[model samples]
Target: MLVDVRNFHITGKEFERRLDEVQITVNKNSVPNDTEKPFVTSGIRVGTPSATSRGFKEPEMAKIARWMGEAARDFDGSAAQVKAEVNALCEAFPIYQ
Candidate 1:
């Protein structure tokens, strides 16, 4: 999934940083400019293979996405809350066993 950060009023890197703070992993990528230089990126790339392997269904994924958006919108105000939610979700879906 690609999350466009333009609407969030922050750069893709910034958004990715906030997600990282909340224990969400995503990549900051952008469409290359004419010179093939990534001068600015407006979107973050989110991968779901890990989550899918951990038995995360649509509902859980949706919750995660919401957490990401919340972090992007207000990391200072929501990082702790989002992190707790992420931990809870991960605990419910153990990677092993």
Candidate 2:
């Protein structure tokens, strides 16, 4: 829930590449959950720039967002399912071809 929506401007690869910078910001503001008290995160940061640039549509973006949110919440199998779906969509769209 604390995910920096602005991070949406950052692609996932870029996010991982610059995790330290991003983490600094997240750590500065993220607080521990009172009950769970797990390592507080700013939540999943997903961007659609590459997908959209490759011709993926809004509906696909919605599915990706849902998968991301579900994965963030630790819903079992969400990540794998999303990966498969993404592969299928990419194949269908054929970005390079």
Candidate 3:
């Protein structure tokens, strides 16, 4: 996205080359302002005792978020796309019932 890398976590020029791979979209972040970014995540852990949400296990909530972080690191300029992939994975988790 910003800098260059050759391989996954290599050093120097060679490491920058790996990023030459084509990019695709997955997701994107919008800071309509700035405050929104700070409080984007501050809600239920077990996900409330009553609500319309489903397939949500508090234990896995953070895990799902981490997935997006990992994906973001994999693709820079394409972070949005990688994030979308992570979101897709979360949806597949049989919790939204």
Highest-scoring model, TM-score: 1
Error of 1 at 41 (Å): 1.2
Stretches > 4 Å off in candidate 1: 31-40
lDDT of 1 by residue, 17-82 (tens): 788888899988773332222645777889999999999999998899799878877788989989
lDDT of 2: 0.45
Candidate scoring better on lDDT of 1 and 3: 1
Query: Residue by residue across 42-68, what tens digits does model 3's lDDT show?
Result: 111222332124455655555544543
Best by lDDT: 1
Pairs in steric clash, model 2: none
Pairs with steric clashes in candidate 1: none
Instruction: List the candidate numbers ranked by TM-score, top first.
Output: 1, 2, 3
- Count clashing residue pairs per candidate: 0, 0, 17
Cα RMSD, model 3: 12.5
Candidates 2 and 3: which is better by TM-score?
Answer: 2
In terms of lDDT, the poorest run of 10 residues in model 3 is: 38-47
